[model samples]
Target chain A: MTSEAPTDLAIEVRGLVKRYRGGRGQDELSAVRGIDLGVRRGEVFGFLGPNGAGKTTTVRMLCTLLPITEGHATVAGVDVGRDPAEVRRRIGVALQEVGLDARQSGRELLELQCGLYRIADPAARSAELLRLVGLEDAADRLIGTYSGGMKRRLDLATALVHEPQVLFLDEPTTGLDPASRLTVWQEVRRINALGTTVFLTTQYLEEADQLCDRLAIIDDGTIVAQGTPDELKSELGSDVLTIGLDPVEHDRARDALLTLAGLDHVTDAAEGLAVYVDDAAGAVADVVRLLGDAGIRPGAIALSRPSLDDVFLASTGRRIEGGVPEMAS
Target chain B: MNETLLLARRAVREVWRIPAATIPALFIPVFFLVVNLGQVNRIFPPSTPFLHGQHYVAFQIPVSLVFAVSSATSGLAMVTDIDVGYLDKLLAAPIRRTAIVWGRLAADLARGIAVSMLVLAVGFAFGARVKSGLVGVLLLIALSAMWGVAYAGIAIAIALKTKNVQTTNASFIIFFPLLFLTPNFVPLDLLAGPLKAIARFNPVTYVITGLRDLVLFPDIHWGSLGACALTIALTGVALTALSLRALTRFSE
Candidate 1:
């Protein structure tokens, strides 16, 4: 695994795919279609996808937990299929479920992980990680007694017990409270700052936008878009103006807004209209004037910068769960 | 190696944390030993050549020990680990894969040995004596514990293959019929026909006979004991291979 660090890419995948066969002569289901990606060293990379979008499967393959049906992948310069043991040695993974052994004390669990990795001075390392995760006081307590957030922190600490070159976290804070989520976000930033390349998968767009240095939006097992958060958002345009209209004259309002000179794109939102224009400030008056001329007085109007949801809508044609873009089914 | 021993220590710690895991396995043997002796002694088959008015309790102690050892061989904890994601956690780590199975089997062997000593004490309390002295007692416990580890392969195979707690439990339940159908209640000499025919081939018959020789006989019968050891060794090796294969094919 340490023979040669191949280029600067910490993770490289070409046409990666996974297919699960259905029983009783049913059609096979493709969990992850062919996907090509290269994640560079020392960057927090995010994989954003809805439920069942193959995020976990891709992570599992990279971490050497799942067999790749068709494709080639390398993590930390080691071929995953050729030497999964080496890939496992170079990578750390905290799975989606945070599966801690309940019978073992938190400290005992970390020590066991250190033992598995054959780390030196496991006792000293376990104490250091316990303090790092803010579980020093509760280190001796059985993991079964810990709260959800505590378990997550312990999981994170154990993943770092080996000092892996790359770390993979699948939905690290999916069910945590706001404060707990913020704590996990800090841990991710801290880990990335320490030069450990982090590959994160999160269902929450906000979490991805906040924590990710670069992100890929995965849909239907295929990556729909990939870039930094701002790059992806700016790809859709500068600003979005949401115009609320009566349910009766929605078509007329859309037609009028489409005719505006500065508007780049117009979409039918849930309540009213969403128009993307290059210069929102310069185009607001034109929007009002056009709608007023059409006798479709808007009940409410707003001009704002386009969020990640807008970028998501532009790419996937459907919003991420609980977005500002008209929670339409 | 070290990895296997460490994992085995972890399994032992889990058993320590949950005392209830060993209670049912241990109690079943004690309960059966007492109930079998009380009921069978009253049946009064004085004409029987195998146990004719002798230490019938010693003959029956091994039967109860067999049950204790077999019942103690379950892999429910392993199944629970699979269900709770702990198994996946271990799989993702860098360790020898066989350590996972060895760890569980080792813990069961430890429990089986403990239960054997406890039942041996109970047998003595009920007036059953071992003519082969203290060494015989140790050998009996060691042999029973060995068989316990050997028989555990069934549950371990099911656990690894199915990774379901209920399914592992169901497999253990299905194994009970074989226990009663063998020469458990009566000596093979008194039995005739297909029952005796089947009992001759059953591995349990050898295990019970091995334990019975140690208890009622004056000296060590090397020939009979070797047969018992060979059967256990063969069964243990076969089951270990099956379970190890299941461990290797875990991803499927």
Candidate 2:
């Protein structure tokens, strides 16, 4: 758990590539083409992408769960392929799926996990983890009897019983109620606060923006953009003003918005035209007046500051499909 | 070794929680035992040399024990573990891989011994005797359980290779032929030439005969018994090699 190495990065990956060879006569599948990443020690570094974008594949390779097809990575200063056992010892991973033993109770699972790592005083360690996860009341009951949220908590607890130097959480809150999701976020923060490096992957931009200290926006199996949330938002350098127009008038609307003043540029969106402007307040009036002068009645119009979703749209040409509810900062 | 027991205990607990999973393996052999007992009672009287004055129920008891205890379903649980990603959790740990394999087999060994005792009890109630007495009974049970442990390797190998429930079940169904052709219905003396030749080589044959010798034969047939252990060891080594090889190639 000591960071004596010169480099403060807990993880360093370079040119990592993975390809799956399909069956005979079938084309090989490419999951991850190439990606490079650096995660600093004791920080929650989020990996965000839409589903099937190879986020899970990248995590698996880093955790030594899957063999890398090309390139390499080091986790906690150990080459993942060369010293996977050391990686296993240093990292605790909660996979995308909650793979708990349905027959075992919460306490039993913690005991098993601690035993797997040969941690001393498994009984005491399991008791502590159970209480930490707020599952003390249900610790003796079968995991199958627990609710979805309880299972998630137990999974997180199991992943942390070893006090790992680095923790990897894959979609930790994908199927939880808002309260449970918040609880997981708090747990992740608490883990990172204790000096454990956190590598989290999620499709939810809001989840990433809220929990991650810094993040990478991954699309199409590669990093499109990476920075702190504030820095990434500043990359847009302007607010997005969206004007919803009739599908029939979309072409004319695009042309009409181009002549407007105080607008940086226009990008046609799925529903309407998006105008980037230095000041949304000044641009909205011009937007309404310009459309009105053209005898066009807008379906709707809204202005919002840059969000990770906007950053995602800027990089990927479309908003993330996580259906995230973005709150104004 | 402690890790092995830890894994073994986990396996056993999973099986115990889903008690329904073991019902077919436990009771199907009882069906065979009961059905054979009624028919054989009418066909082979005590005077019949086929039983050699030993109770017909005694002659058929080993078959039922073998059939029941050696259901080859240990790998079915292994497939479920793989499918549900529980195996991944264990693999990510720093434990020895052989512990994972042997731990699963230990649970099957327990189930085999449990069922073997059940069949032996039923045979005793119906006048089947262990002429060589308690040690003979223990040997019979141990032999039956060892076969269970051995065939468990085959089931586990199939599970690891396919990682599909349907394929694992079909593989278990195919195991019937292995036992049926090995003199399960009649002793080798009554078997026809081709079946007798096959039985001469069928490892299950040695397993059953070894068990029956401990029960009905005048003295312990060390040749048959030693053959039983050797054959079990051979099948065990081959199937274990297959499973471990599959494990090494896993997620490659």
Candidate 3:
């Protein structure tokens, strides 16, 4: 169904495609095959995908770092292909690969970046950015000495220097620890709060579920599902009740759970049998009682609302974290 | 213009930040000039009318400067850019693509000029004279720096395409032939056999001949100077284009 045209739509893509010639005796592979999306301004839009799922490719195209092989895309009202330079002007990007000049101190590098963006009062801006990233204390230190998290923060700061309309972050927290990941999340929220549209790509489902207003789940170079976290979860019907039984009785447990009236889907996770049904509260008690009657003693049991993982499993019949072959035909 | 200047300034500032590396980059050519002159001058014939009766040290000073300039590769900087992802960042920026290429080229040219002038000053300490005077001195510096910048464009193109520092380093094989095939040591007229024929066609031979004419000869050789300038300008344009093409491919 079509929604109202967003007045603040900062990015729009219609059937965008990207293809790459595989190296060393391999055939050509299409990384992104006809993906359409729209990201509203001042909202954190996440593109969630596993590694090599064309997340970076899509972000690159939107940021004007890459050319579209086919189809059309626009960033902040500028066509990515026809006017990439202008798109670049209105957008800031922190790519998956951190791009800090090692020889330059944090202050010097930021100053140079400000100059490149033709920012007025570069020194003040650089100082402010350094402070924003919590690098003011070490601003004079060379970037080579900064830790990975520090580098990432500096990169984020660099992207914000130009006050861009759209900010694209490609898997920004891939290598960060939990605390640093949270810090990046906070900065991302802060950036969005400043009236900038944030387009982020991430592998962490929880991160997207927590931070993104809406997200597109991409797999094998295509958008398989798109909606808010709650909307996608709602599509899976109701809650999920996972019952873990002892002594490896998964087959019997699966068979027994599938016969329940309210249950819609039954699948096996490593730890237990996952039962999806219309009402978790109704189904969970029945599931345990049935398992007990069948002489199946559950060691541990959990009942909760359907998560993004369940939504992914419902659509693709595979765990979101499971390895899928790169560039699905 | 502001973007170009900013980029060029960053390149310069980066080089300055690492004194250990920058010092060696400047020192090697000056050291070679001192050590080679003492040993090579004994074999050279007496100075001719074209050489303006200058001593062997005076004659070789300009050649050494040219040699020094030509040897400064921009590949290391390109490799650094690749490692830090700055190259990709620049590609994604709104700045003119040509400005990125030209800015790097300009930085290389400026560095080469600075080093060559430093070597020339050292040579002057040893009694070398510029026969065409300050104007000739300026031309010599410009030509040496241009050659360096042109060759740097080639280096940058190779670095971008290969994306491997070792491979780019090994590609200096091309420069070996360019250096020795030219009349780097002796006058072009004094060369012999296939070497003389090759020197006639070598672009660097024209460059060195032009520098030698300005530094050692009494009169200006405008034709050689013009040819050298044109070759460097054209080569810079071609290699810069190739580098930019590689950058586009890389981003894709």
Please report the candidate that would top TM-score against the real structure: 2
For model 2 chain A, the run of ten residues with the poorest summed lDDT: A320-329
Q: lDDT per residue, candidate 3, A1-329, as tens digits?
A: 22223355799999999998799999889999999998987899989877888999998888877778999887887777777778878899899999888888999889988888889889999999998989999999989999889999999998989999999998899889999999999999999999999999998998999899999999889898999998998887877777776536877777766678787777775576677778888776788878877889887778888888777766666678863211110
TM-scores for candidates 1 onward, in order: 0.95, 0.95, 0.91
**Model 3 lDDT tens row, B120-226:** 89989877788888899898888888877877767777787788887776645677688778877677888898999998888778777777778776678888778
Instruction: Tell me the deviation in Å of residue A253 in model 2.
Output: 1.6
- Looking at candidate 1, what TM-score does chain B attain? 0.93
Ranking by DockQ: 1, 3, 2
lDDT of 2 by residue, A1-329 (tens): 43233567899989999999999999988889889999999999999999988999999899888999998788988888788888888888888888788878888888988888888889999998888889999999999899988999998988887899899999999999999999999999988999999999999888999999999988888899999998999988888887788878866776777777766667665577777888997888888888888888997788888788888877877678844323112
Two-chain complex of model 1, DockQ on C-alpha atoms against the true structure: 0.68
Query: Considering summed lDDT, which 10 consecutive residues are worst modelled in model 1 chain A?
Result: A320-329
Off by over 4 Å in 2: A1-6, A268-271, A322-329
Better of 2 and 3 by DockQ: 3
For residues A1-329, write the lDDT of model 1, one tens digit per residue.
Answer: 24444578999999999998788989998999999888999999999988988999999988888899999998988898888888888899998989799889999999988999999888999999999889999999999999999999999998999988999999999999999999999999998899999999999988988998899889889999999999998887668888887877877877777677766777767678788888988988898899899987886778888877777787777777754444321
Candidate 2 docking classification:
medium
Q: What C-alpha lDDT do the candidate models reach, one value each?
A: 0.84, 0.84, 0.80
Cα displacement (angstroms), candidate 3, residue B182, comes to 1.3
Candidate ordering by TM-score (highest first)? 2, 1, 3
Which pairs clash in the backbone of model 2? none
Better of 1 and 3 by DockQ: 1
